[model samples]
Target: MTSLTLALDAMGGDHGPLVTVPAALQALKSNPSLKIILIGNQADIDPLISHADSTVLNRIERIHTTEIVTMGDRPVHALRTRKNSSMRLALEQVRDGKAAACISAGNTGALMAMSKVLLKTLPGIDRPALVSCLPTVSGKPVYLLDLGANVACDSETLFQFAVMGSVLCEAINKNPTPKVALLNVGIEEIKGNDQVQQAGQILQHTEQLNYIGFVEGDEIYTGNVDVIVCDGFVGNITLKTSEGIAKLLVHQLKRGLNSGFFVRFLSKLISPRIQAVLSKMNPDHYNGASLIGLRGIVVKSHGNADEAAYLQAINLAATEAKRRLPEMINDRLESILLDINS
Candidate 1:
């Protein structure tokens, strides 16, 4: 049996153990053999777990961490000075080989900071990218890269992103021939910047990728494309915008249904369909993003993730850990980089 031990920064998120403790418990119910090293103040975390089941308590272990790396602080400084912080401690567990992977629903900057400084990147990977999957309007999920990691990416970096994102799709999403596209201001190669234009040309020539040229923002929710590549700044904005739009749609749907007798009558007729639509749109479905290209597996969840949200994140972590995602990436990437250089 594979020992799937994961270190979680229980103190790193907005809700802290309030949500973390329950999430951990929920994950355990599904993954019984999973070993967890909760990094947080015992006093803070203990209270949350006190009334819980004995069996759940037995499987989970604790590594008390007092200091915390806040979201607003400078990321690099927080990592350095907050030596005993939960995020740092949790990351160290993976770096030291004590754990297979690390999961955090905390500061994105700090998580990326610790990843770059401690885990390091694989050879030929210029930088590690944050990659997430979002449900498209077409009902399929698309892989979006650099979702706020590397804001300024070059042509070669984009090529690397395609490779990593495709491999990820194959592993988790079962996307055999994952179509790759560059997110442009317009759907044409000529519509993008010099870097993007250059990347478009390069992707067209790359044999490894199923490159499909350029795509626009609206096309993302349509699921016409599989991999949407962009710099972190663009990807981040696009993701947040999509989230906001989804929320707005849900908000309007709720209001429209609750107004009056006619509205309520219409709502009853459309309730099932609307619920099905909203269920698919729920952020929990795509709750985890892999910090790809690092020496080890590191997944980041939303800062305000709830129990079910973290459950999705942990499911991702467990799958990757069992498959030994880090080792697999290293193996597959080594020969590719070598071939490119040769």
Candidate 2:
């Protein structure tokens, strides 16, 4: 593989440079052809990488910026005012072709806004959607999109999201015909709101997509479908709620395992299997969400991600960059649009 550079918002997360710097270095170590541009306050970043060897230092670059977009910052404020912020600059790197992709663990709203402005949406893409993968019963990834990017979406926008999601799923999972579905209250035809029902109608007629019917929340992890499309409001709630449930399950299991002596002995017998299952279900393993439909690549990491989780985000960025995901989606959308217009 050729060298691919990723720009990182080093000061955008809760731990900022403390977490990002180590993850960057570790990414470089794992992928020899990877280069990183750390965008943040130089003072904080320098000390973290100061003890690194020449080989490591040679592949890293820094663009110093003291400005940061906090978690509390509004999207409009960040886009209009914080031009020099780390998140903005990191996105700028992708826009200018200085980086193959940009990754941030910053304010979600601000990051989404900045990325849209700097990267811009591709032709025929009305809006960029946020997409992330979840573990499934079949052991294949189930891609979910529009996770809090646009709170309200029209039928056409939702259809666009389904196309984008399908393309992304195919690219990442190598499934030629990824099954797509709309999240709804029920699998029946007349269950969803007009927007969802209409989008489903559009998708059904689009021969370019493998449009399946409605899927309820219970089917998200069933892996029966590869892509589940929804408006941002519903997608965000579903994602957060799933994350909470996963955490609760893990915590309860660990607590039970540590409880009485007899239980502890029983736990030892089944601990390895349970731990293996838990490891696969860990949220940190799936910490990055791609902001799709943009002209360039951008990944949003969890705000409180640690080095391990942040590294997973970096890996995601690298995969998308290598795949040239944006160009792929652009091409697919163009083909689909031409077919519709014809």
Candidate 3:
């Protein structure tokens, strides 16, 4: 099997090389066939590599650049001004076919903007969607799309998201005909606005789409649907709210367990089970969000992600690369368009 190569934006996130270098090392250790190209200032990256094992260090390569894209940098400004920055350079590797995928913990807006411009959108896709895996009650993940990529969308865009999301679920989850749904106020047909309702009509008529009508916010984690499509404004708010609740639940559990001797003893008795539950719900495990519908693969890690979270993001990119995700999306998209035209 050919080894997979991923480009990393070493100087893009909150901690920059401090978090990314360690994460890259961990990912390399986990997958012996994996090669990583770290793009950033060599002055900062070399010292971090010096501490790694020689065996691991041999598989790593570096592309140096002094410029960095700040977290506050505007997407347009970064595109025009910071072309040589780590994030842009890493993405360029993907466009040039030097890397199968690119992973970055940088400005979300800037990353999407640069990727769309460089990698370009796939045929039949109007815009790329920010997609991520969310844990469900059935021990499988449900794919959610448009997580703050485009704030507003038309009915056609929503239909395209459903197609892209369905392909993603099939690729990642190995489901042949994944169940797709539209996120709305309620499960009824008349719950959403004109755009959503119109999108629903299109999905219902599209051939081979396993669309199951509307899904409410409460049903997201029920494992009832394989893909959930929504506008970016709604999707972003939903994703952030879910993250907040997961953190709160974990914090409250820890606090309640440490209160008094009786509780502490009970916690020790059930700590393993509690830990298992918390681990499944941890946002760190689901840190990578794919910018779907682009010609090349790009996984976006949370800006504040630590070593473990960042490693998960790298793993996500590698998995997608090995699966040939772009090809799968293109095939499925062509089928969807053909159905529409027929």
Error of 1 at 138 (Å): 3.6
> Which portions of model 1 miss their true places by more than 4 Å?
265-276
TM-score of each model, in listed order: 0.93, 0.96, 0.94
Candidate 2 per-residue lDDT over residues 38-125, each given as its tens digit: 9999999999999888778999999998998988889999899898999999999999999999999999999888888888899988
Candidate ranking (lDDT, best to worst) = 3, 2, 1
Superposed model 2: Cα runs more than 4 Å off: 254-259, 268-273
User: For candidate 3, lDDT tens digit of each residue in 280-310?
Assistant: 6777778999999999999999888899999
Residue by residue across 224-305, what tens digits does model 1's lDDT show?
8888899898999998888898899889879878989998998889899989878767877679999998888899998877
Winner of 1 and 2 under TM-score = 2
CA RMSD for every model? 2.0, 1.6, 1.8
Clashing pairs in 1: 137-221
Model 3 stretches astray by more than 4 angstroms:
51-55, 251-261, 268-276
